[model samples]
Target: VWVRGALRFSKTPNGGEKLLAAASSHKCLIQLEDVAAESEREEVVARYFLKQGVQVIVYLGDITKQEADALVNAANEDLRHSGGVALALSKAAGPEVQRESSDLVRRDGKVATGDAVMTSGGKLKCKKLLHAVGPEKDKAGGRERELQVVQGDIIHEKTDVIVNSTGFKSEPAGVSKAILTAAGPPVQAELFNGQKHKFIYIHSGLLGCKEIVHVQTDQEAQATNKTCKKVLKLCESKGFTSAAFPAINTGTNFKKVEVDPNSVEYQDIAKGFHKTAKYKIHKIERVQNYHLWSGYFVMRRKMEMKNSAAELGEKYLYHGTSAESCHCIERDRFDRNYTGAHGASYGAGVYFAINASYSANSRYAKPDPAGLKRMYVARVLTGHHTLGDSSMKSPPQRGDDPSDKYDSLVDNLQSPSMYVIFHDDQAYPEYLITFI
Candidate 1:
């Protein structure tokens, strides 16, 4: 009988189809010859599996004879039951599977890499056999792997739920822009009506995904962390079996927010925003835990190498810096609320190197002033709007105050780890000192 492309199989007098028919019907083995042409490729695939610790044992005998739980077919790009192993399996499974595989592939493209299609074993010994393409075709491997961080298009994720970050007022432009844009007009309409930061919103038919979740939170690192925590809780509450978080505040792309600064979108959906209401994250307990962990484990080592680090421990009592660009000389003392007279600002985190150098500032501070372990560990937290040393030392900038001009020039941060604090005759620089 003709099969696949019909190259003609003249060796087996009984032919593969007849043998597979009997094997499927009787649930018995059908002794057959080796597939000389494709044996090398089969070995390669098996070797790949074996290297992954799968303990694969390739059997050259007919697959229909094997009584394993299931058998797999290395299908062509189209997944059709032409000649080769596919024809033998299909003939054994009866003619119906030709239609099954074709229709399924029609509905879902050629089974791509890291993907598989299942079929009833016809009359074969086992109940089912799976056909899959290998990772050489790594198209959708991202989904096949468990949870991972990727730096490409978020819209392509096939997970159950995708998390997009937005604020009470609106969805920022970064990944949120891509999400809402691909999500279509309905998602935009929904965003215009409410401040669902704490709440979750669901939409359909935007992307091919099963569902989309919009998380409202600040774009800051800690804020994104809080949004993630909320998304996890929402998943549990809604009984979602599986979920995925497309890069949130930090998207593979950039962040651009679209909001009618005066429109007040949240006014209608929720009672959270007003004309000038700023976004805030209250649940920082987890953030504190993380900062503390980084402080004790990661940053603590850096401090241990410093000569005068003991002095810091004695006065600040807390000398840990979370890797999130945070530099803490003293714990519990980083008054994120430090807004001195001239409208200067300081965040809960600070960015500083541990080099203990008298030099102004440097991402990699020069050879340690002392015999400290001069090493660059990570970026300390910066970007708190702290007006340079002048801001820390004087009153807030008033109109005609050159401090504003200096503020413009204030602490441009020569290095990734540059910030200025006051200097007492007895101590090191006291950065982030919003108050005199």
Candidate 2:
């Protein structure tokens, strides 16, 4: 038989239609081999699967022969085999597929969340049937639980997945089904919305696909670049719109350094963003933790490293002179930077880096002098809207005279700041401060 411009010939002495007829019957192990003059037909089929975003499951051995309990079906409550794997199954099982699903839906009206229906294996080798609702936003705009049910079953290992007739409106039937297929049964079945569900973990060998990469210094920056490239390739391969990244290799991976204003690492993943989808960077940190303080300082030290993936207009230029020693200290202080009164203010924006011990006593301990500049800038930008250093727990009395041109610069109140406060003087802390 020919479909989508691909010729199909059966291994048995029969026409292509006979093979399709056998598939429709769901007859066990209808093995067939390509008989075209060339393998162009096979290429066409592969391209068809790709166009639809379907993940073709190829096992070295028989899959259906394996014994398993429940088989999970990605079925619409409508029970009509419409598109995706559903349509494929319906075609394979003849009309019996629709008959069974229709019978179940008749009894259930519409399946509720976490609901299922059982059916005979029919032509397929499996036994009891399960019809669970994947996530869906109905026509009325109410949330449905389709994803929770399908995802849950896919990850169960005990259950085999049979996805069918599911799709998002914006995608073609094949493409939507394919993405859902790739997400696997776990994400498909698991409910990740308002309700709570059991935590099911599956190791797809993609580094579990959920990990944090902490980067804190120039050395750490090198490692982070490599990781970013690797992650970008992974996402590209997967056709994902975006991937979230935690500041990688920045915490435990870099050398220790005194935290200072010049130490923040803020490079953009420009390479990852070149694709149609935008990538995001999630800075995961523990506030008020001691070890976090050290890592934050280390990252700040490496912020200046040239990033291979930095986006255009995303890099920040630093022109301030380094003040490593007391003797070399020049025009350095928190208030001085905020007022734009002392440092080279050509166009440097403000950044905060916190490093400290997480101990309660150490939490409030005074920050390092070098790192104090970051805290000071953050405080000025986020907390108090003063021209310079001033307490915000209480604002300047309305009638209080503008003591100086600096005090007169106070604009609106309640502007937020990004300040990093580390508690440990000698080591990184467990938490960093984000006082706004």
Candidate 3:
């Protein structure tokens, strides 16, 4: 991209207007015609004009102030709007921006690399001031050591080059050219290693009632870790090397536990799989913490319905008495705190179970630190077990009692030496699955 100048103007005789018009027309420079003002030239005044998509111009004696939609402040790691650019922005705007910035700082420990915070530009001409933290200024002593360690890792990882600059910088290393990009299905397949696994797609009642859809389930639901182990046995029987899984029956099936997709349940399962199986555990998720709970509440409205015999039976059997109601009858303390405490307990339970001792070789649940990761993975598989499947072909169905379901996957392993492949995603070479 380059800039091309058009024609220049004279220094006399109504030349300013003519030059301005000419400049606008040809995207040329507008200049004073002459020092000797002609009668028509006196009428020609330089009125302040701003145009869209036009380069700014300043006359020889004009003083210009930078006009921008907003100003950015370089804040400290603590997000304090203090000193240097921070002070400048604070003075321009009101103290409110600083206060908001401080609040945000308190909320998220230190601002990390490539992170930013926004605040209202109280009295400033700008609408907002975005606070950004640059890399740590102190790059000596310990900083150098840390940088060297990080640089060594990057180099060891076969990175081509490292670029450094103040302000804006660009690198020639195109992410698109990488051997594998951590996005879309290819990455997923690579992580999972073609592990034929199943997941229970459990939609919350709230999600089912919403006009705007929210939740989507995977394959099936397992009542406990036993179900997970059973599914792995099935996968092994089918000659699958590995599989990616989620907390099965626990999420939607188990009431009273608010199942966050990213809770400890998922984490424990991933870690367990990584620990026990010779496979990669690709945990695909996003951080949607508060939104899930809030959205659940917002979609809690009930719909009118005509009763059928089956519906009547369901109502009579499950919800006939207040004590036995299966549906979310009323917004109680449980619903209010489900997202935080209630959900957290369930997440913790799964985390504990996965982290607890287990013996995969013997297909038993014990407090074996060595087998915790495997147990967690087994738990995730349990989530995939379906109730309708026959026991002769499939592992036992998930029951309310978790102990019975424990280690079912290991017990049902078709071969003692079956291989486990940890694929990062599904698109990893299918040949890898065959190798397993």
Candidate 4:
């Protein structure tokens, strides 16, 4: 009907003024306080009449000040009243309103896009607050782009594609493991069994998303960049409008160089090899590497600076591989893609042994045609590790928190003979030992 704000009747209207005058007696008028006298005398902007004999009036002013029955709040899915109109409404309604809104989301889950939920307006003029989640920009084929860095769990994001970073085998680890855990076992099964492509797509089962794009990445800047590009391309090809990615390859990168034979470092490394190796060392060639050794030192220094309770847990370990793989390791550093080349009893990672004899097994150090066996003396970062199993694709969480994870995995925590490192940069090949 005829709700009054600052209503002004038109004098030039043909019969509009006469009809409004006739219905003026039946109009329901609401007097708003502190309005300018001139504003009260302004002409009506526009009006529409429905078939049910009701008149709609349009008014422009502060929405929070309006004494409407319900106020619609443009809110995120979680109903966080942080900015813009949502913040203003929440401020006007007081903190209790936000608590009520959060309680609603917690009880009924997030409000989906194009849908809404209602909460009682605490101190606001409106009686009820309608929290509505709107569609993201570019979702409906718009050209504009929007980027946001949100600090929270990625699994809670509602996007067309959720990226899961893994090794070449597409086995879940780190963030990928968390994603798979949330997505349920079926998604993990499909991830392993599905045909290999540039990227693997698994249905998001229990996850609050549409699909999961598992991309293989190693602890290298180049690999991270390549993974990002592939993910974008995959999303484009699949016609997905939105995707979520966690911090991929958040580890150091290393380069290998041949160490000078006359250097003192070389003699010390050779002496250590002579002390540890069970087999007779035919030769010990020191290699200059900046990743695992330097990375371990950096982590140790950082821990000391922060005065963290955990120790760095640095250990000199040995890894045995075939001649071809040895060359690859020397060239490009340890690649987690070949994680299970020998065995993955501890975990799917680059395995190292505290005892050289353990790694010197024929199964690991495959003999060449000339019967020469090769092993690497690597400085491994085994910071706060725990016992791991064959099923583990990554180190388990430190405690109940998923974000805080162990730096490495071991066969035994008390006396770890074997250490498994998921991140490639966590270990560096310092010396190459050739023995019969």
Candidate 5:
């Protein structure tokens, strides 16, 4: 928790915007040894060398022009390299950066807020590039008023219940300490008043009309989804309209994920760490009718579109044929100009019924949103024999008879194993399975 690097760096007024600009623009080439020598003697250079971890070294410098083991690109949810660091890294690393980033997005869904991915660096000096989607940034003056993020001592929160993260030998640590200190000795006594299980929901007079939910974790480093879900369900069932959750994991685990507080990755991890708080809060909102915000707003939009398709009396994919298909129409006319209309699926290999919506585009098919239906190719898998020399680009050439080639292609298509491929971004949609 203590930033030893900051105190050593801040002792002298070495860091500022001006210094960073000058350091980056310096024409003189500095070698690794020279930088190292300087760091040993010069305090500023020493500051540049941040945390010397067991495996990783966190540094503060121009990421665009740094000699590192790997550089991370703060990517969009779709893993597109856009403006700022993303754009700079793109220009430095070239097209392969975007391609590899795309592949990761293709395999996995939109990179989660805290998830980190590694890809080839392309033209960059580093050995690899890490792509991660940071949490959505606060938009304009809207964020502060919304109060989605609350920072301070957890004990001070005047809510329905302040969630006490108690797990792995609970005496008093972190938020538990603050809560016990604030709420007189009676609250602690009430917590243990015949609490049989890990999840203890106790009514407390010390913390006013509120109560306390002391939850035991999975005893692992990270809190599981089940644990987080339990807390939320308890809040709704108990009718605690408002709840404040402290940081879940503190002293229990021997390991800690350390990152620079100012960095994008760190912020994302911090947001991820407190995801329980966000999840629990929203569940309470829906239960108490605190607000009319939907948890699945994006899906709701897709449902509206599906309803539009249903009204047109279009045949569902599974109705006549075993296959189902949907073209991603432009959500609005304004979205027509955009390319890279990626496609996704609801199921792993199959697109679920609900998956017909926007998020279903796993392949990121950049279809003309204006076009009602794009050309989807009928795919056939090679059965029994693998085409060792086949590229599937143009028909096999090299003195092969035309009739033989045609017969082979037909045979592959007719094979029982040769079924249609789903959620494949690389495979162009040459055959139309239309709803309209």
Candidate 6:
């Protein structure tokens, strides 16, 4: 049995007061309304679990003022405690609560959705504060759409569509294999029997979903964004509202492999430098080959940058600097504060050169006491660039729209020899080479 509104003190013909008095003896779980303001008076809004021994009571009041042993705050994954109930709770609990939440994220990374991290309640009445990250609505999709992060098998999810990441032929591998196995033989037969396409939609035979979307994974990072947009468009066309997708290409798709000196990878890099080296070679020095790791944060920023740019136009470029600066760049990454160190001819940003000889000049690459010059072979994202001048600090607006801005600036649009990016993360130092 369920009850609504506050229990009255006056006796009723149905013996409601007797039932309410009996409920007072049992242990009750009090849940405060999330929308309630701090100044609101406490009142019983609803009740459940009448048949069971447990009593579930919903009260209209501020969660921070509750005398419960613990209080739960709806929080983001980062636990910034800057908005909504999180902000209110943080204010009531004191500064230590926010500080501890930040420290927790730094130590253990961001808390996953549907997971909760505990912290001291500080000045609050509760002894502990549980920061719970909940599923958020997909704002990009629509107000009616929600985005949830769930664990367990995707094949078991009951949705309109299930996305499977696979090769062109849809060979059974990784998540694709598991999905096909659960979907039964008909799905596999349709995938192999049909003409090869980038995306193939097939009927879900045994799987819980109504349909399956097989996406051919690409090596380029930009492909991820493109595939998502394509999938959403397809879903909209098909009138499908819900879909479940496995974490695509989050595994060994992109790995940092050390380029062996004898391997073709090393030779190709060496050839690039030698072909563009205007100065005559005196003596060849050491070339240390190390592939930069693309961690989670880096990949996330890359995707965002790719989506903003008209054309990703990624290229292998060179950056020359001192030995001390090289060490700092490797450890701390590129710093925009040091922009214009060589000269902001294009813009006040980190500059990269298509020709290694340009960066090899002493003006940019300072010689160490040992007489060796250092340079870096970096992966630069020269996206949707236009010719720039010293007056500009950032990329200019792409067109009439102020919100739309160019990703980077170039020396020349038709044939860009130099690229300047205001964003530090736009360029990653992949290989550092030392020479005479």
Q: Please, what is the whole-model Cα lDDT of each candidate in the order they appear? A: 0.44, 0.33, 0.31, 0.72, 0.43, 0.73
Q: Could you give candidate 4's per-residue lDDT for residues 278-304 as a string of tens digits? A: 677666776643333334344444443
Best by TM-score: 6
Which ranges in model 1 have alpha carbons more than 4 Å from their true place? Answer: 1-145, 219-223, 236-239, 248-436
On residues 1-115, what C-alpha lDDT tens digit does candidate 1 reach at each position?
Answer: 2134222443556665765786699997654344565443332234335556776565556676556678888776577666678779877776456656765776788887767
lDDT of 5 by residue, 127-246 (tens): 999887777645333332122345334544667777777653657655565455445567677665555577877765345337877777565655656776777777778765667776
Clashes of each: 13, 74, 46, 0, 21, 0
lDDT of 6 by residue, 101-211 (tens): 877887899999889999999899999999888886664354565567673346657799999888865356655766776676788889988887898989987676778
Tens digits of lDDT, candidate 2, 373-420: 111111111221233232322224334555211111122225412221
Tens-place lDDT digits, model 3, residues 1-436: 1122222334356755665776699986544343343222323234454666555444332111234565567777786555655666665565466556656765777787668877776777666667777776443323221112220111113221211110111211221111111122343243235332233221122222111111122243444445545545554465443333322222221123323333333443333333534533323222121222222222111111222223211110000111211122222211222112112211211111222222222222221234321121110112221122112222343568653332112222332211111111100100000001
- TM-scores for all candidates? 0.26, 0.19, 0.21, 0.38, 0.27, 0.39
User: What is the Cα-based TM-score of model 2?
Assistant: 0.19
lDDT of 2: 0.33
Output candidate 2 Cα RMSD. Answer: 24.2
Number of the top-ranking candidate, with lDDT as the measure? 6
Error of 3 at 264 (Å): 40
Per-candidate Cα RMSD to the true structure, in Å, reads 22.7, 24.2, 25.9, 21.7, 22.6, 21.9
Give the poorly placed runs of model 6, Cα more than 4 Å off: 1-259, 278-310
Give the backbone clash total of model 3: 46
Candidate 2, superposed: residue stretches over 4 Å from native: 1-69, 137-436
